[model samples]
Target: MFKGSFVALVTPMLASGEIDKDSLQNLVEWHIESGSHGLVAVGTTGESATLPMDEHIEVVKLIVDYAQGRIPVIAGNGANATDEAIFLSQEMAKFAIDGFLSVVPYYNKPQQRGMIAHFEAIASATDLPLLLYNVPSRTVADLKTESVAQLAKHANIVGLKDATGDLNRLAETKAVVDNNFALFSGDDGSGCDYLCQGGHGVISVTANIVPQTMSEMCDAALANDFALAKKLDEKLVGLHKELFVEPNPVMPKWALYKMGKIKDPCLRLPMVLPELNSQKLIEQRLSQLGLIHP
Candidate 1:
């Protein structure tokens, strides 16, 4: 049931590097008002790597609490350790979250069989629907089409967020799985194309800065109006490229701060602010899109 622009929400942080509850709640309200289809809390764009387990769980809970069932909140339950993933899913299942976005096991690089088993175990641990996430660029472990087809058999495993950005995988994976199984593009750049080619939606990073455009684009594509979708997507093409000028939330958070959506653009250690040049580029894109003043 998860479709449209599901923003990989960036967790707003205070100057002290603590979660900004007010900004988090404000973001949730803003997304709902802005017509974003869903929110993926604590995902990679949310800086899941830097957040400790307690903080991770807390963010998901806070998002769920703030959303109040207006929009779906997909918790990022990905962990390299199978048991840790399962535990995170089990814990998040206690909240009102709609599903779990479990990424392919990273760092360790599990085999296809291991990946299947890893996902199956997490799916079995909770009743919430599970969406497989395959962003091999970061995870280093690709979930093969065959493996994804195998995991799609589980009743709780409903969909996948394929970040490989390879559109060919769309037809290839669709050929193997049932039509009802949702395939969401995790890459924002090709998101509209993916939808035009039969993807259900996008788990978008760009949506963090431009929710309305992303939502409208996905809605148009889903409605089979490709011309409108492409038009809307063109407005986001620059944002899609520039937001990744630095690693994920660094640029997104800074964009939000510039737009007055959040207080501090502070990231945890290891993910500092974007370089001055990168900031200038991001600002240029934001200005071009009229998201910020020149």
Candidate 2:
């Protein structure tokens, strides 16, 4: 049931590095108003790595509350440890979240069989629909198409967010899974192309800045109006590329702050602010889009 521009939301923080509840709630309302289809909280873009378990759970809970059944909320419940992934899934299931975005086990790369086992265990732990996330660039562990097809058999394991940015692989993946199984592009740069190629939706990072454009682009593509979708997507190509000029959420947070959407562009330790050159590049893109003044 989940589809369209599901923003991999960035958790707004105060200058003290604490979660900014007001900013978070405001963002939720803004997305809903902007026509974003769903919210994916505490994912990589949300800086889940820096957030402690308690804070992670808290953010998901808050997003659910703020959404108030108006939009779907998918909790980022992935962990490198199988047990930890299960624990997160179970804990997040207590909230009103629509599903879980569980990443491929990172750091300690697992075999295909191990990955299947890892997701199977998580599926058994909760009835919530689970979306497997394959981001080998960061995880170093690719979730193979065969393994994904295998996991797609589990009722609880309902879909996947493929970040490889390979449209050919998307066709291959679509070939393997049943039509009912959802396939989302985790890569923003190719999101419209992904939809045109038959992806159900996008779990987008760029949507954090231009939720309206992303949502509209997805709508056009889903409606089979590829010309309109391409036109809309062209406006976003700069954001899709530049937001990652530094690591994710750093530039996104800064863009938000510049837009007066948040008070501070605070990030936790080990993930600091973007360099001045990167900031200028991001600002230039934002300005080009008319999202900010030059």
Candidate 3:
């Protein structure tokens, strides 16, 4: 059901730190037109952690409704607390969401047994298809392949978003996981390699800014057109280096706001505005790509 390029959407906000609804809807439509296969709301790219519950669920509902089945809406239902994840999971499931992108429990590192229990409880609670998100850089506790393959036994646990960046682990997961189970790259930089190693797609942050190019790269990788994929990857070469010069969405939001595609691009506390240097880098690249006005 969920396959191909899914953009990890940026949550557009006003200067006063409120989400801009019209801008958000427009962004969703833009992704659909640019050939993104689906959309992920309120993930790391959206700064999901900083959003209040009402705003979070509201964003999920808005994206689900906006997508209107043209593409799947995968809600980011991740929390360090299993209870918090459960609450958000149930809330999002109330909408017409096609799937839940559950990050490996962040902050409070859980053991393998705890990880299994957490996902099992979520599966028991809702019918939304589950996409296990393993971005160890943010979540700290990596969801290992042994455990992920074991969890894939559940009918609802459908796929994985691997950010581990270790090609060997991806190979292991592909080797052990069920033939029907799917794998998608979570790291934008090495996404082509992951696809070559049997990854079906990517949950991409880069796609938010350059969906056409990202979609082409994923299509090439899926079709085993390594030559074309490499060609497309060159267009995105700086994206991997610059987007993280500060942190995600900070740079991405700047890119979009510079393009006047978004309004204020306010980021929440603890994760403040980007450094002037980082923002300048973003501006320079956006200009170079012709994505921003001078």
Candidate 4:
């Protein structure tokens, strides 16, 4: 179903910034063991923006290989240009990825017609089922529920990743979209509410650190166990907020490094470390939760 606790997996790097395959594979195996439903590789968490084309594809290919049937790999293939997105999605499709997570075009800020054409072009060029990603916070172009409804009618466009953190439109999209198309929340903090409000699940950066927590939360919500879901949600609230204290993946990488799950906690250019004050709090919570050695 491609729903529920898809980790926006970070591309773990060595101190010198080489792709840390050993750590990446270990993380994949860990997610499967931890009950993650799927894995999203080369995403914002994976630092896709900084990765070179070849390296990006290589990361996707490697994750597909290492996962070795353990889980589905939803490769992030977003770009400002439809043609570029097409080429990238096609390249990524050569691997064992189960689907593509393409974002709404950014920077150039295309209009609604352009948005329709962009996704339609990619869907035309490749057969990969797509989960449309709309994070206007980063992309700057919001896809209205109307455009999403239009796109969902396409044969290959399968679902949406709603990062706007607005439930009103999510309810609208879920109400109007074709029968089989689905919706997923990209925001982690209220992801439980989203799922219960008819979203299929989440593409969660929070899952990178709390894989089991996310998976369990989604399962609880799906089973209509709000009481249990609330308890797990409480366990993850500080984690969900702190991970985004600055830029995403910065604090997430930091938390994982302290857990000995990763090597150096470095992000690529244009992304910097969080403030020193916040790092202590981040580590403090991790210690309080016993995620790190005290």
Candidate 5:
């Protein structure tokens, strides 16, 4: 049921590397005002890997409580371990998040059957809707087309956020699954085509920076207006690529800082701020888009 320009929101943090509640509140307001379809709080862009369990749940709770049904909030519940993911989902469910975005198990690189087992276990544990996240680049283990179809059988396993960017899989997955299964494009560059190819929506990193344009593009695509969707997506091409020029949330956070949406783009340990060259490229793109002063 979740669709359209759901931002992989960055967790706003202080220069001291602490969660900034005021800035986070302001960001929720800005996104709602800017017309983001929904919010994916504590996803990859939200630095989920770096956050402690308490902090992660706190962030999700804060957003859910603040949003107050203004928009849907999908809590990031992916973990390397199946039990950890299930426990996290169970804990967060108490807060009443709209759904959970569970990524493929990273580092371990399980086989398709193992992947199926992992998701099925999580599905059995919670009645909440679960969106499978398959980013082979980050997770190593690719959740194959057949594997996704297998997971789709479970009642709670609702949809997928596919970063594979293979449009063929859009048609492939749809061919196998029931009509109710939603397919959200996680690859921003291919999002317009994904929709035109019959995908449901996008779970976008670019939307964190340009929520209105992304939301409008998804609206156009969903309306079957490829002309309008392509035109809107064209403007975002620079953002789609540049935001990932460094590891996520680095450049995205920087872009938000430049837009004055957040105070400091401070990241946690192991993910420092972007370098000078990367910063210059990001700034040039932001200026080109008129998101920042030239």
Candidate 6:
């Protein structure tokens, strides 16, 4: 059910780090109007690591309510603790959220067997389809190919978001997994190639600014129109790289604030605004892409 440009949405917050409820709702509306395929709320780009559980659920609930089934809402239901992950998924499933993007258990660095067990337990916890988020750069514990194939067997374990940026593995992954299992790219830099190589879509950070473009690009790639897809993807190459120049959401949130899309670019402790140099580069790139006026 999850395909196309699902934006890893930025959680709008005030200068005091309070969740900007009105701004958050407005952001959701903007994405839907801009033709984003779906929304992935409170993911790493949304600063999930620092947000308290209560606030995390509140953010998901806000997106779910605001979406009102207009678009799919994939709640970021990942945790290092398997039990916590299961509990959060079960609770969030109570809402109208369409699915869950459960990242690999981070820091703990579980073995492949342990990874299988962790995800299986989560899949059994709720009927909601689970998309395994494997961003090893942040998680440290990579979900190896074998483990992913094993997890794909579970009826509720629907798909995977591979952020490794290794397209070679896609062929091998497709070979073992069921045909129905979706494989999405979590890396925006290689998203077009990933789609060309048979990825269903991307859970994108860049889409926070260029939702319509990203959606169009994914649609073109999925439709086998590589010429148009490449054309669209070329324009987004700068955003895919610079958005991560200062850690996620740091630059993404700032870009939004600069575009006047949000009230404040304020981020939680341990993540501040980008440096002036980084800001200038981002602003120049945005202007070149016509995301904002010069």
lDDT of each: 0.94, 0.93, 0.87, 0.88, 0.91, 0.92
**Deviation (Å) of 6 in candidate 2:** 0.2
**Clashes per candidate (backbone, < 3 Å):** 0, 0, 0, 0, 0, 0
Evaluated against the true structure, the overall lDDT of model 1 is: 0.94
lDDT of 1 by residue, 91-161 (tens): 88999999999999999989999999999999999999999999999988899999999999999999999
Q: How well does each candidate superpose onto the true structure, as a TM-score?
A: 0.99, 0.99, 0.97, 0.98, 0.98, 0.98
What candidate 4 gets wrong by more than 4 Å, as runs, is: none
Instruction: Identify the runs in model 1 with alpha carbons over 4 angstroms from their true place.
Output: none
Which of candidates 3 and 4 reaches a greater lDDT? 4
Give the CA lDDT, 0 to 100, for residue 229 in model 2.
Answer: 97
Among residues 3 or more apart in sequence or in different chains, the pairs in candidate 4 whose N, CA or C atoms overlap within 3 Å are none
Model 6, position 107: C-alpha lDDT score: 93
Give the candidates in order of lDDT, highest first.
1, 2, 6, 5, 4, 3
* TM-score of decoy 3: 0.97
After TM-score superposition, the amount by which residue 5's alpha carbon in candidate 4 deviates from its true location, in angstroms, is: 0.8
Clashing pairs in 1: none
- Per-residue lDDT of 83 in model 3: 86
- Top model by lDDT, which number? 1
lDDT of model 4 at position 34: 99
